[model samples]
Target: MSVEQVSIEDLGRELGERIAETPEYERFEEARAAVQRDEEVQSRIDEFEQLRAEFMQARQSGQATNEGLQRVQEAQDELHAMPVMSEYLDAQDELEDTLEAVNEAISEPLAVDFGGEAGGCCQD
Candidate 1:
């Protein structure tokens, strides 16, 4: 028996295309677009980011940022409360689970593990 020669890049590209065809991926894209169009959601996200930065800077400078931390938590909650953001988060989880399953399937035969490795867009 002869093993077939195949390009890893081609296989990866085909896998990506197949994943993109899934309904979960489509929903993820739609949810992301909805979030993008929501000004309130975007502002809440920006607020959390700015507060987080302030908290980090305070930590770096050995200063207190309890207020910033509290504000960041509030902003995070507000962002999470948005319907569009909630939908986006749900879709994101679904897509991530699907990709993890695919990665496991592909890595199993190759005797490798793709879980917990950094550098992917879904990095935790």
Candidate 2:
């Protein structure tokens, strides 16, 4: 190939390095690290997951109850209320928005959605 015909792999690596240097990326990294280091946040997340699993099992066994549902909801609420989890979630949203904007810019010249995984129709 000619010198003018650069590989997409090289371009992708260059782009990734530049993106990592941005303040947005730094904030995301710091928030992610903080969340990981917070034992309280991790514990709450584990508890919430456990409660959710129990709820699912109960539902599958036709043994679901309002109390079980309430327990799961309460655990979820407690987890979301944690400062570390909230900050991490906000940072994650910011990062996703940044990525989507980048994708739009990348796809604009081609007039195509240069693309990410398309989600299923069913809502969680």
Candidate 3:
């Protein structure tokens, strides 16, 4: 079929399906599942999220302290130090890299940056 015969939405959906089948995507999915199934990682995530939320609330109320910000940073560091969390993060980064390369490829033939500028407006 000619390019004009396929709807943009259909092409987008097909692209998404193809991306989902990539090895990077598969690794990311597996790593995500492992993270979800690990109680220790989950607990650390919960702790980090709670600390971050409390920090945000304090900041919103104009009562945020350096100590609170430090606590949140420490919690984030501790969470990221976990083996499972590290693996998940690495897999996620690889998947993001793959997507970025695909985005560049798609953007190259277009007038705009397909991934970054397609929906944005008010540019000079």
Candidates 1 and 3 compared by lDDT, better number:
3
Across residues 1-124, which tens digit of lDDT does each residue of candidate 3 receive? 5665888899999999999999999999999999999999999999999999999999999999999999999999999989999999999999999999999998888866877868867887
Task: Score candidate 3 by lDDT.
Answer: 0.94
The superposed Cα distance between candidate 2 and the true structure at residue 74, in angstroms, equals 2.2
lDDT of 1 at 122: 56
lDDT of 1: 0.86
Local accuracy of candidate 2 as per-residue lDDT tens digits, 1-124: 5668769999999988988987778888999899889999988889999999999999999999999999999998888888888888888888888888988898888766666533455633
**Top TM-score model:** 3
> lDDT for model 2, on a 0 to 1 scale?
0.86
Q: At residue 18, give the lDDT of candidate 3.
A: 97
TM-score for each model:
0.83, 0.80, 0.89
TM-score of 2: 0.80
Best by lDDT: 3
Alpha carbon lDDT at 69, candidate 3: 98
